[model samples]
Target: MYKTIIAVGLGGFIGSVLRYLVSRLTAGVDFASLPLGTLTVNVLGCFVLGLLTGLFERTGNLSPEFRLLLTTGLCGGFTTFSTFMGENFSMARNGQFMLMAAYLIISLALGFVLFFAGYAFSAKIRL
Candidate 1:
């Protein structure tokens, strides 16, 4: 457990730094209301995670710890959106179409609501 935690932490640090660099690099890119930098990272993260998942499955040489470091830690730290997408993809692949649809709807709706709720709560705080 401790080793897994450390692996995740280290991977998270690296992934987070990469995410910051990517965002900074694309900070000036504008595309209407869409956040280009975030979109880039999320898509890239998803692709990378997918590639890693396939590679690991085919190779079957890497340990679970390494997988955790990359998927749950690196990609997770880079963009949780990728993780969310991955979960949905897994569900779809497993033929849980209805569950995936429900999850998709609930996640989007609740995520937006919680985001605004947090923003509103923060605005009311003095310090």
Candidate 2:
């Protein structure tokens, strides 16, 4: 457990640093444009994570540590949006259109609702 935790921490640190670098590099002289930097990283991260997942499945030999380190840590640190998109994309590509659509709808709707709920709850807390 400790090893997995440490691995995730290290991977997360590396991924976050890379994300910051990408953002900085892409933010040059752009104050009124789309967030291309974030989109770029998210898409790229999704592709890489997809590749890793496919590789693991094909090989059928991988440790939980790898998943924790790469998927939960690296991709998550890089951009959780990528992971969410990737999962939906995979389902759609595999002909699980209904599930994909449902997941997307529920995830976005519930995410927004829950986010607002948390914010309101926190604001009301008497601490």
- Which candidate has the highest lDDT of all? 1
In the order shown, the candidates' Cα RMSDs to the true structure are 16.9, 17.3
* Whole-structure CA lDDT of model 2: 0.67
lDDT (tens digit, per residue) of candidate 1 on 1-127: 9889988988898889988898899888875423456555665665576556546645667878888998888987887576567767887898988877866665666545544454454444443
Count of steric clashes across candidates, in order: 0, 0
Q: What do the candidate models score in CA lDDT, each in turn?
A: 0.70, 0.67
lDDT of 2 by residue, 4-96 (tens): 998899879878988888888897645333344655566566555665655555554678887788877887788757656777778779898
Which pairs of residues collide in candidate 2?
A: none
Clashing pairs in 1: none
